[model samples]
Target: MDRQKRQLQILDHVDLTLKEAEFVSVVGPSGCGKSTLLNFIAGLTPVQSGAVEVFGAPPGGTEAPLGYVFQQHALLPWRNVLQNTVISLEVKGIAKAEREQRAREMLTVMGLDGFEDHFPREISGGMRQRVSLARTLVDDPRLILMDEPFGALDAQTKLLIQEMFLKYWEENRKSVLFITHDLAEAVALADRVLVMSSRPGRILAEYEVGIPRPRTLDQVRHMPRFTELHDAIWEDLRGEALKAMQGRA
Candidate 1:
């Protein structure tokens, strides 16, 4: 008989709560298990030794409606823009007519209305990300887990997409757990911002973002409260970030 080996991963002392229709953001240094936290909640991986619940039940249950968007836009090359947006609904056995109408409406909101027939490769990275978002939002999951969904884009495009994302979220108000390395982005969009320690990750600190709702990127950035929250979170994160860098070094 051959012996089997198993690998173990741990997230130490992590505790979090997200309320109904709340948008929470998590920020941390690299390799701090920020993405792992999202994955665990989304039930992409099994939860071990911790009480993890979504909607009063353990994660991964069919009753818990959730959506996840990864950093990479995992669009199918073969699918056109409209086709990509409706794939999730199609999987759920939605009728073609209803799903198409939903996809079209979502694409229009995402500013991809004119490029419906274009394939993933035919669109810009920003547009592909929009389609990815459209696909995720088309199903209207009660909870959404996003892992640095805009980290790959250039600065300008990232800002544009961030504003667009906030617009949708403000309107729809889904419970979102957004994971990002960008502290400002975290503060800009979240009701509460969580900071995590280096590997063997745990929640180090959290700041309640006091900025008003219905926020615009330009307006919110200039507010004193936004600066206050961002700076406080950064102070907590800087040491852990340095530790991560030194560990890598």
Candidate 2:
């Protein structure tokens, strides 16, 4: 397919599967179709070839709920944190009181308890992203797609949110497909990390992250196994990333 006067071939011969409650992370060179893959799975982008399914059905074909947290929080600025979080439930025709209750519970879990009534403008970017996460989780989706959700935050805030995210995932065990350029982030949060080639992206390698669960980002980094996995994947990713940069230049 052509995008903006250029033929944009995003995926080629890419076959992937995510088991229930699996956490898989995809990392690749810029413009290597990481986000594109997520969009396809979420049914936001139309697929011209090959099958894309969730829960044994075409994307959005099943009754299973799906949640997405994008790089941009995409929260409605007019709505307070609570109202923003409950928007999905409201769309599903949930009752007002019940939606509010659920939203409050999720916000609390996301560390946004006292900030519920605060507008998005009133909160920090990290907090806004937390609200975004709470919004997605409120529906209790079986599958969650995150497209560089922490990419915009400062390092400290990013680390904090990452830990919080790990906690939530460990507790709920929802299937997640996380996309990021940060190799460490990918390795730390995922059960498996997939590396992709540049341009018409394809899976170049898949590395199983054998690090034990109930993991904190700090603790994971100290492990020799984590370093070994990160280095190995970086070697494979480095060439593709250079090619992508050269193409842009």
Candidate 3:
């Protein structure tokens, strides 16, 4: 499909029968059009040819209310955490009192209870990302799209957020389309993992993660099968990652 000047072709189509409460991860080498596909779903970019259906409706035309967390926190530095979170609802014409109340409830869930009045500059990177998640979740989206939502955090923070994400997912159970380049992250978080190839991206492999849930970062690291799956996916992604790096170099 060609939108504007960009072309998107899903050479190896992977059908996603996401249930009401499942987390699905898409992992691929950087620049494999992962973000592009997410944009198509978000209606930020139109699907020129191939169909994109979310909850049985074409996304670019009549999509569900969506909550997206990008690679960056994308929080407004000027707005305090609470104010920043209410932007989306405000745009939708939701009342200030109701939205703020909902936003506060979300902030509490994300561990930012007392920090609501703090500016984005006042918080740590991980906390900023949490604020970003809070901002998105306040709207009660049917499906949340996460594009490397924790890619920029430190290793320790990444692990913390991964655990936090698991807790949140378990509680909310919203259908998720999480895109990440981190193999372990995808394996640790998703019910099914979609692996894609390089440019003119195609789904190369799809693996259903049979591991038991409430999986913490430590438990995932220690799982015997985790190493096996990681190695297998890494082997698949290595060539593409190297190719992408070389192109950039």
Candidate 4:
């Protein structure tokens, strides 16, 4: 199907038998339709052929809920942290007091306890992304689709947030479809990594990460297996990445 910015054609199909509480990372060269796959799962984009499912049924046909976190954070500047987190609940018709309480509790988990009243403008980039994460968790969704949620953060802050995210993921246990260009990030966080090739993207490779849980970003950096996997994937990606850059030139 045609996307506004990119197109997707899933062929020789592969399906994710995603069990509950699994974290899966998707990586690909630019224009590989990584985010488009998420949109198809979210029912924001239609599948031209083949089936797409969420919670054992077609996405839009089921009662399951999905939360999305974008690269931009997308938090409202006018709203304080707590209000921003609760806005989704409010829109879903949840009671005001209950939604506020739940939203604050969610923020605390992301280490934003005292910053509940802070507006987006008043917070640092990392903190804003935490608030964005808190907002997604507050909805108590079964599935979360993250599209480069931490891509904009500084390296130090990205490491910190990545660690914090693992903790949150371990505790809450939700199925996630995380999209990223960072190969290291994919290996560190995902139970399985799906790599896609450039434009009209298709899954080129899928690797299962057997690493144990509570793996910090720093730990993943030092693991031999991590390097092995990283290099193997990069060997495939380097060509695609170079091709993409050359096309731009």
Candidate 5:
């Protein structure tokens, strides 16, 4: 509960866990504290009650690497691609040569190879997002939190980035907590999907993707199991979505 507004509870008794190399996606109606949950895991918000542990340790203050890719590109306009990618490392006091080398390698893997010197304004939105991903991943964070990182992109760019992200996850196998509202995108990208309640957010249900990985979004959406899972989750989500909308109205 907010001390300022005692009745304004954001989340209540929400429980979640992401295993090693596991990819989990969370979906719910708007204003369900989905981002609040991410903030808790990222250590940006204080845990008012209950507990949050990463690898059996409290998050935020450890040397353990943690990465976050937000909805916005959040790239520095003045900094070139390579420079932006290594900013985290620079803050960590890594040697300049080592940080640049790692950042360059990640940028290359992200398909930004020849655009190292390009500023944020010079690149497309999609390319800027790739740089953001490269920056977050360059430090090799064991846990990654992505809050609708592709939510702002066009359909084509979203699909392309999904594929790119899948490739990166397949190669590195990092534990990820992804927040997205698109049911199809959630099922396509995650090993498991979590649904939350309308307000005072809580986990409503969990669905295993069951679909094979190395999955292309187009291919997975066409599968029978994908449809089944999507429909089933929608049954639970639809009501909450309606309730949220009505509350807004």
Candidate 6:
């Protein structure tokens, strides 16, 4: 969507892009329509105004390459982890051999090396999320839309998953639009960060994370630049969050 006159019931004057292989993050207070914005881009919610295009094509159009990882691990209960990861390929009518191979590789990369036969219930929350990421990445979509995929995990688990995700991104560099409430996460994983305002959400601010390349999640946090960016982003985000909580914006 262009920056000009963009609007939706929950979003307004919004414009953004995930350049080829670039990583981006959006942060804002609750109800700022962050998730709503993602829904529009993923084509789960139609744009009531302006437009949302993926890879220069309308969301879900034939030319768009997209994948989404929702906050909840929406895994199939009856299916084993391996089966769940291969479902998308299976739907595309890929040969069983090829699909399973792709899924296994992705699962291994996501750090789900051996629990392939386990059901979702048999694994920990973080592993379940690893399976979710595995499922999404197996499709090899050019653009990934993540909606707080790590929000439910404990601190350690979240950090572990974030590290895994960053490693994957560093190597593959697929375009990503990650949504989160964690300022540290936003700054750590994205090349660019966006802050949205309260209901009737709009872009409030943008930050470019310039801590340098070959950055590690652990190392970045201790860097002076990381703290600086985090503080700066929070200064902008905090106000909107308060405004949202107070219902004054």
lDDT winner: 2
Q: Mind giving the per-residue lDDT tens digits that candidate 5 earns over 117-226?
A: 99999999999999999999998999999999999999999888889999889888999999999999999999999999989999999998889878887888899999
State each candidate's clash count: 0, 0, 0, 0, 0, 0
Higher-TM-score candidate of 2 and 6: 2
Give the alpha carbon lDDT tens digit for every residue of 147-233 in model 6. Answer: 999999999999999999988888988999999999999999999999898888999899888878777888999999899988988
lDDT of 6 at 35: 92
lDDT of 6 at 98: 97
Q: Per-residue CA lDDT of candidate 4, range 146-186, in tens?
A: 99999999999998899888888987899999999999999
Q: Report the C-alpha displacement of residue 33, candidate 5, in angstroms.
A: 0.5
Error of 3 at 64 (Å): 0.9
Give the residue spans of candidate 6 off by over 4 A.
1-8
Q: Which ranges of candidate 2 are over 4 A from the true structure? A: 1-6
Query: Against the correct fold, how does model 3 do in TM-score?
Result: 0.91
lDDT of 4 at 187: 95
Q: Mind sharing the TM-score for model 5? A: 0.95
Name the runs in model 4 displaced over 4 angstroms.
1-14
lDDT of 3 by residue, 1-249 (tens): 655865446434544566777888999988888898889888888776777788788785534878889999999899999999999899889998999999999888888899988999999999999999988998888999999999999999998888888988887789899999889999989888888888768888888887887777788888987888888888888888888789789
Instruction: Go through the candidates in order and give the C-alpha RMSD of each one to the true structure.
Output: 1.9, 1.7, 2.7, 2.7, 2.0, 4.4
* lDDT of candidates 1 onward, in order: 0.91, 0.94, 0.86, 0.86, 0.92, 0.90
TM-scores of the candidates are: 0.96, 0.97, 0.91, 0.91, 0.95, 0.94
Best by TM-score: 2
